[model samples]
Target: MRITWIALLCLSLVGCGSEGGKTGAAAEAQPEQTFSWKLVTTWPKNFPGLGLAPEHFAENVARMSNGRLKIKVFGAGQLVPAFEVFDAVSQGTAEMGHGAAYYWQGKIPASAFFTAVPFGLNAQEMNAWLHYGGGLELWRELYEPFNLVPYAGGNTGVQMAGWFNREINSMADIKGLKMRIPGLGGEVFTRAGGMSVQRSGGEIYTSMQTGEIDAAEWVGPYNDLAFGFHQIAKYYYYPGWQEPGPTLELIINKQALESLPDDLQAIVESAARAANQNMLDEYTARNNAALIELVETHGVQVKKLPDDVLAELQRISTMVVDEMAAENPLAKRITDSMRVFAKQSKAYHGISEEAYYKARGQE
Candidate 1:
C-alpha cells in the first residue's frame, strides 16, 4: 500500500509539471499585438520628396517593427483635405499626419517657428536647433494642447524665392504684386507692399494661370519642375529667404502614439528621422539636375533677387516677426529661442560653412 501511494504521488507531480510546461509553451507561442494606423498628408500622392517622405516613413515603420505596426499613407484629399491633416490627427480621425508646421499658424500663431521663420535657420542650423538646442521640447509643449505629437518629417532645404511672371528689379516692383505665400512670410510680404494670397500646392498653378496671382514660391527646382510652374512663369528667382529651411512635420495623435508598444514607438521615431534626412538628400541631388533642365530645356530664366528688394523684404520681415512675437507669449518664446540659436549658429557657420563654400566655389 505504501509503494502504490508513492507511485500515485509521483504521477500526480508529473501531470502538474506537464500542464505547467504546456501553459508556458502556449504563452510563448502567443502572437504579438499588431497595429494599423492611417497617415494623412498635405502633399499629392507620391509627389516627389514632400509626398514620398511619408510613404518612406510608413514603409520604414512597417519594416522596423517586423510587420507589427503598419501605417497607411493617404495623400492630400484622400481621407481628408490637405489643410485638415492637423485637425484629423488631433481629433483621432487619422492616427498620423504629415505637413509643414507653418500651415497651422492660424490655429497656433507660434507654430511657424517650428517649420521656418522668415530669415531664420537654414536646414543644418534648424536641424541642430531642433534636435539639440531645445527646439523640439518647445515644439512638443506647444502641441500638447492639441493632443498631437510633432516630429521633423522632412526639410526642403533652401527653397527658391518663387516663380515670377515679370522681373523684380527693385522694391517698387513688389508693390501690389499678388502672390501665393504662407506663414509669417506672407505677413512680411503684405507688409512689404505685396498681396499675399494663401493657396495650396495644387491650387497655385491654376491661380497663376488665371491671373489670380502674379508670383508664387513653391519649393525648389525639383518640385517646381514637377509642378510645371515653368510652363506658366517665365522667371525663376533664387534664395528663398522666406523659407530658409522649412521643416515639414509628422504629427501623431497623442492617444495613438501612447497606445503603441515601446519598441514600435521607437521605430516610428527612427523612421521619421530617416525620412527627414532622405528628403534633404533627395532635394539636393534632384534639384541640381532639375535646375539645369529648367534653365536649358524649359526656357526658365533663373534670376537672383536684386539686393535692394531682398533688403526691403528683410526689413519688413523683421517687423512682421516682431509683431507676431508681441501678439503671443508662446510666439515670443519660440521666436526668442530661435533668435538666440540662430545668432550662435550663424556666427559659427559664417566662418565654417560659409567660408568653406566660398573657397570651394573659388576652386
Candidate 2:
C-alpha cells in the first residue's frame, strides 16, 4: 500500500510537471503577445518611395516591438481601391491606410491644409507647423469625426508641376486645359480656368497618353520616370506650386488604435515619425540624381510655367481659397488656422530661406 501510494504521488507530480512545462512553454512561445494588422495603401505594391515606405514602416514597427506587432501591407486594389483606402480604414475593413491627406478633402475640406496648398509652406516649413504651431492638434481634431487617428507618414517634398502636351506661355493658355489633378489643387486649377480630373496614379499615365488629359502631375522626378511620362509628353514643367510640400499621412482606425496597449501605441507613433523623416531624406537624396538624369541623359525638356500663368494662378488661388472659406465652416476654420501659421512661417522663411536662395543665385 505504501509503495502504491508513493507511486501514485509520483505519477501525480509527473503529470503536474508536464502541465507546468506546457504552460511555461506556451508563455515562452507567446511573447508579451503578437498581433497582426493590415495596412492598405493608395499606391501600387512596392511602388518606389511612396509604396515602399509603408512596408518599411511595418517592418520597423515589428522589429522594434520585438514581434509584438506585425503589420502586413497591401498595395492599391489589394484590399480596396486607392481612393477607398481612407474609407476602408474608417469602416474597419482595414486597420490602417497610407496616402496623402488631401485625397480625402471631399469628405473633409479642412484636411487639405494637412497635405499641401497652392504656394503654401514647403516640406520643412510644413513639418515646423505640424510639430510646433498647433497644426497636429487641429489635424487630430479634424479626423476625430471620421474615427481616424492621423500620423505624418511621409512627404514627397515639392512635386513637379506636370508633363504637358503643349507649353503654357500665358494666362490664356490655361483656359480649357484639362489636367488630371486632385484635391485642393484641382479646385484651384478649376478656378484658374482649367479642368481637373481626379485620378489615381495607376490611371494617370494612360489618361495622359490617350490625350484624355492635357497634363498630369504626379510626384517629382523619381516617380515620373517610373510612370514613363517622358515617353509621351515632351514638355515638363517645374516648381510644383500646387503641391509644395505634399504630405502623406497614415490613417489608423480609432477602434484599432484604441485596442492597442500603451506600449504598442507608442511604437506605432514612433515608427510613423521615423518613417516620415526617412521618406523626406530619401526623396531629397534621390531627386537630385533623378533630375540630373531627366535633363542630361533622357533629353527631357525642362521649363517653367510662364510668369503670366503663375501670376494668374496665384490670384485665382487666393480667390478660390476665400470662396472655400466662405462656404465650408470646417474649411474656413482649417484655412484660418493654416493661414495664421503660414503667415508667420512665410515671414521667417522669407528672411531665411528666400534670402539665402537669392544670395546664392547672385553668387
Candidate 3:
C-alpha cells in the first residue's frame, strides 16, 4: 500500500511540472509589434536636394531601427497632392510629411515664421536659431494644435530672385505684375502693387510657360535649371529678398510619433538632423556648377535687381511684416523672437562673413 501511494505522488508532481513548463513557453512566445509608416513629401520623386532629403531620412530610420520600423516615402502626387500633405499627415492618411511650413500659413498665421521671413535669417543663422535659440520650441508650440510635430528637414540657402518675362528696372515696373510667390513675401509683393499667385513647385514651370504667371521664383540655379525656366523667361534676377534662406519641414503625426518606441523616436530625430544638413551641402556645391552652366551654355542673362527696386521692396516688406505681427498675437510673438535673433546674428555676420566676402571680392 505504501509503495503504491509513493508512486502516485511522484506522477502528480511530474504532471504539475509539465503544465508549468507549457505556460512559461507560451508567455515567451508572444510576438513583438513592428511598425510600417508612409511618408508623403511635397517634392517630386528622386528630385535632388528637396526630394532626396526625405528619401535619405526614410532610409536612415529603417537602417537605424534594423527593420523594426520601416518607412516608405512617396513623392508629391503619389499618395496625396502636394498642397494636401499637411492635412494628410494631420488626419493620419500619412504618418509623416515633408514640405515648407509657409505652405500652411493660411491655416496657421504663425507658420510662416518657421520657414522664412522677408529679409530674415540666412541658412547658418536660421539653423542656429532653430537648434539653439529657442526657435524650435516656438515652432512646436505653433504646430501643437494641428495634431502634428515639426522638424527642420532642409534649407535652400539664399534663393534666386526669379525669372521674369519683363525686366523690373524700377519700382513702378512691379505694378500690375502677376507673379508666383508665397508666404510673407507674397504679401509684400501684393502690397507693392503686384498680384501674388500661389502655385506648387511642380506647377510653376507649366504656369510660367503657359502665361499663367509673368514671373516665378523657385529655389536657386540648381533646381531652376532642372525645370528649364531659362528657356521661357528672358531675365534672371538676383537677391531673392523674399526668401533669403527658407527652411523646409518634416511634419509627423503626433499620434503616430507617440506610438514609436523611445529608441525609434531618437532615430527619427537624428535622421532629420542629418538630412537637413545634407541638403544645404548638396545645394551649395550643385548651385555653383549650375549657375556656370546657365550663364555659359544656356546664355541666360543674370542680372542684379536695381538698387531702387530693392530699396522699395525692402521698405514694403517691413510694412507687411509689421502689419501681420499686429494682426495676430502668435504672429507678434514669433516676429518678436525672430527680430531679436536676426539683430544679434546680423551684428556678428557684418564683421565676420559679410566683411570677409567684401574683402575677398576686392582682392
What lDDT does each candidate get? Answer: 0.91, 0.88, 0.90
Kindly list the per-residue Cα lDDT of model 1 for residues 1-363, writing each as its tens digit.
357976787576745446554445666787999999999999999998899899999998899898999999999999999999999999999999999998998999889888888888999989999999999999999999999999999998999999999899998888999999999888888888899998889899999999999999999999999999999999999889999999999999999999998999999989989999899999988999999999999888999999888888898889888988899777788889999999999889899999999999997
Q: Predicted candidate 3: what Cα RMSD to the true structure? A: 4.4
Tell me the tens digit of each residue's lDDT in model 3 across 140-186. 98889889999999998999999999988887889999999999889
- For model 1, name the residue pairs that clash: none
* Native-referenced Cα lDDT, model 1: 0.91
Q: Work out the TM-score per prediction.
A: 0.94, 0.90, 0.91
What TM-score does structure 1 among the candidates reach? Answer: 0.94
Alpha-carbon error at 171 in model 3, in Å?
1.0
Predicted structure with the largest TM-score when compared to the true one: 1
Candidate No. with top lDDT: 1
Candidate 2's residue-wise lDDT over 141-176, tens digit each? 889999999999999899999988888888778789
Which 10-residue span in candidate 3 carries the lowest summed lDDT? 14-23
